[model samples]
Target: MSNQHQLRASVLASYGATALEIEELLAYNQNIFDRSFSTLPTKFPLPPEPHVAAWEEYATLAQEIGVFQALSSKLVQLQFPILEGISQTQVYRFATRKGVSADDMVEATGLILQQPEQLQLILHQSFVGVIPVLLASNREDFVSLVQALTMRNEPKPVPDSMGAYMVTGFNNWDRVRQYRQQWSAKNFGNCSESSWLEEFGRLILQKHLYQDRLIILSDGFYSNVSASDIGLSEVEWRRISLTIRLEHECTHYFTQRLFGSMRNNLLDELIADYRGIVAAIGHYRADWFLRFLGLESFPDYREGGRLQNYRGQPPLSENAFKILQALVKSAAENLERFDAQYGQELRTLNSQPIMLIALTYLTLEELACSEAHSYIQKILDQLRTSLKEAEEHLKSKP
Candidate 1:
């Protein structure tokens, strides 16, 4: 009977994304959480002995091999992981074990005709270390360290098969429009091919490799960059950095760690994009992100994007997803309230950047888990109550 419920029903109808009933979605969330969060039923398979779990170690391997380098700009000094010789690494070994050939991977990368060694591994260090370890059956530790490394920036043209390009309507209006049209035609008419599966085939491998210490895995990263053989140019790389993307991807790092790596956790995507947009640009603008996703044209685009991301993997219950969309929509629409309460404290914290960063990730974590509508109201109420506490505390600071 509330606006939130109405929005959820409308958004679901728009996408035709199959959502379970309230009870069903609740059960699904429970089942998935237990499956993913709990200890695995079986030990992760490792490479046979004689091939020591770390038959090799590459702490300075990237530096020694010289495939990827780190780049610095005014804002962020970004580092990525790129490996030239896929045939030699555990990545290829594990892909092969999973029945995906190196050739298949190369094809997926859109770097076909290029040797596996020639294609790059564009990942973070966390992925860099554990990938090979898991391939050889060595990912086990009581404590875990997930360190992701961004690779050096290299300008290479992406393949035609990777779906849409990352260029925006703001920059190239006509082409972007055409690209969106083509996408609509495609999503409407055909089945989406798993070039993404091959393009990002490593994720299939990532799904299985979690343990206590030294557990290596990627929570999530769908960088709107080259998924194929084409490399990124300085111009494109600049777009990624200066725009909302760097924050966007960084948000994935935070949320993936918080929620575990999976796509379509709409809350994860929305919160990531929201925090990324707000933290970087200093206000919330759903239009830019919605446009980026090609969902800008949707009549209910903001709510629609949230729905689509939910459909990506459906992290919350059906009603819960709807509630989330409404909650965020209400927050954005009622910015004065948020700003007066939590926003002021956040602004004060942002004066010192590191504190702001920590709070941003933690706030997102709290918001993601507060699914009940009443719980959401309670959080907002607390934010409002914090105002009085701040005023009293400040007056008492003498």
Candidate 2:
């Protein structure tokens, strides 16, 4: 076995895997991919019409009432450009006017409650599926909106310098449904809430009916790194930064939707960052990814970079963390080599999804092993065969 395989086995052992069970981990991960393969959608879903309409109307109201103005004022007053400075408690107190029923303030704040848009509400068509995206041009507005939705209008510390947020299974009260309910009450005296009406309302409204998944993105340099930091012009960096950030979050959405897991783990980050870089630049650049993770100067981890975010559940020991770093560096470099060789073939095959699926089949350790390229190629080949068989079956039916 090569040194890379030795490192792989060492990392697995740290996670409580016995030396003999290394292959078991590989088999387990492969089983997950195999199970998910059959159910993966041939075509991703478009954004639901009703959901789009509801958000559009809500965004219009938020704009008309100057909610963005209030939010901007509050953010400035707090001297926090990002939402990380405020707590959810603070946001709730400010928006509710200290629990007083200031009707106008409450109404305006309520409308601004969840993901109030500063720029626009885009129905983004991602590789996995269409997801609603709340694009905020101003960083302050983005921070405030993220705080309102994720922290319940309360002030809370967001530790990392994150550029985008993905909200899943969000139980949001539908403003459109609220407006319709109010209109009905005003036109008719004391309209009783019937069971059928409740069910119908649930169907039409985003509220208790469905799991609302949205991506709240900021127009900021990725990971709060400035344009000059990477030697790119501001205009060019901003454009690429936005693409990378959106695709990064979408990659998480893809895994969560198809693989039943989205984790704050190094493996997940590596996979997402790979997809993001490819989407932005048409190929993966290992050095760019290393800089993003603060691993540009290998063996010397940057203190405040994203690598600190995935320290494991109970956290790894110091020596184990260093080993993990080595694994990440090796895996990233291996992926770059694989991409350089087979990128065009993968693209021509329209097998980006398959590529993602293949990644899920291997462990971070295996990805760092000497035969990583061959392992990925083997999985890709099998997936291609399965895909072709499915297509032929459909053609025969017609």
Candidate 3:
């Protein structure tokens, strides 16, 4: 098998195998899907096939039963479904990256941890990685986010019922063409940049009516390129994911009203990153992992009011590599702590171990930023406090 195949399987295995019954059901259904999807000629313009009926059978079966529901739940955990568990008040604050104050973040944090394990069980059932598969298939979230960028935010009152229509335009080869057009002058081909840009453009263009919107989501990684090349880093990726989710829901919230879009890319990005971290910590205590990894801090405010790393290095600098290694080590140490405390409960919960997965990314990112030790600590302090409150709230409920 290819390296990519192995990696994907490794990720699945890490979450612990799905229930035997769920594996059987999905396997059979998958066979049916493969047989149906395969018979179609491997050519463009995937002809108008009436496979919706078959698809509906698969979809309905998953939803009405435990396996699919569990799979969906687990996907949210692994991907850190940035938009799923945030509170409504936080929706805008988090989206704008200012919806929640420090106090609010603290309270929200407790609630997240306190949520009943039974609820999380829904995420770890039959096909543990169901959400990722769905994300790949629908591409809806990604597509919708790109479409949101076309509109400008107006400065008028957006009615509570105003709804926007955000659609994804291209999903295949056509998508490739549009992406190439957007970054024609640059060289992005080296890092799966071509494909990523293509999909991003299609999503953005879908929102031809608007011009001041943003989207947050993760892109598939092809290589180990550092963040200096692009204007994003490992830590920034998590934040970006949160920002896109906010823009997506905001588009829907302000659907069809005369609301001008918000500008200020720097502020916009900063807010997204900050908000993403806060929300992620609440659900997964991921910020702690970032802290341990030493890759958790953003560039310090430099001369000219811009953010720059103290090291003056390019993306994924040598320091970043060292940080990553340290993070892995630290995480192993912490897992022992976790096992000592909540390990048994974890086994009984029977839910997807989202905590471990989310923590992994956080720790890795933190390690990557180890050079900025002081800055990393500050952010972690804030993140941990917020998470504690969110957890407290969750526990209080039951």
Best by lDDT: 2
The C-alpha local distance difference test score for the whole of candidate 2 amounts to 0.67
In model 2, which regions exceed 4 Å deviation? 1-35, 44-53, 56-118, 175-191, 194-208
For candidate 2, the 10 contiguous residues with the lowest summed lDDT are 74-83
Report every candidate's CA lDDT.
0.33, 0.67, 0.29
TM-score per model over all chains: 0.37, 0.75, 0.21
Off by over 4 Å in 1: 1-61, 68-243, 256-263, 292-309, 312-341, 347-398
Could you tell me the lDDT of residue 38 within candidate 1? 24
Candidate 2, residues 317-394, lDDT tens digits: the string is 666676667778888999999999989876642577778878987788888767899989998888777777777777
Give the winner by TM-score: 2
Model 3: per-residue Cα lDDT over 6-100, one tens digit each: 34333333334334422322221111101111121221212222222222333445656543343332211211223332323443334223212
Tens-digit lDDT track of model 1 for 147-208: 11111112223321111111101111122223344555766754245543343344334322
TM-score comparison, 1 vs 2, better candidate: 2
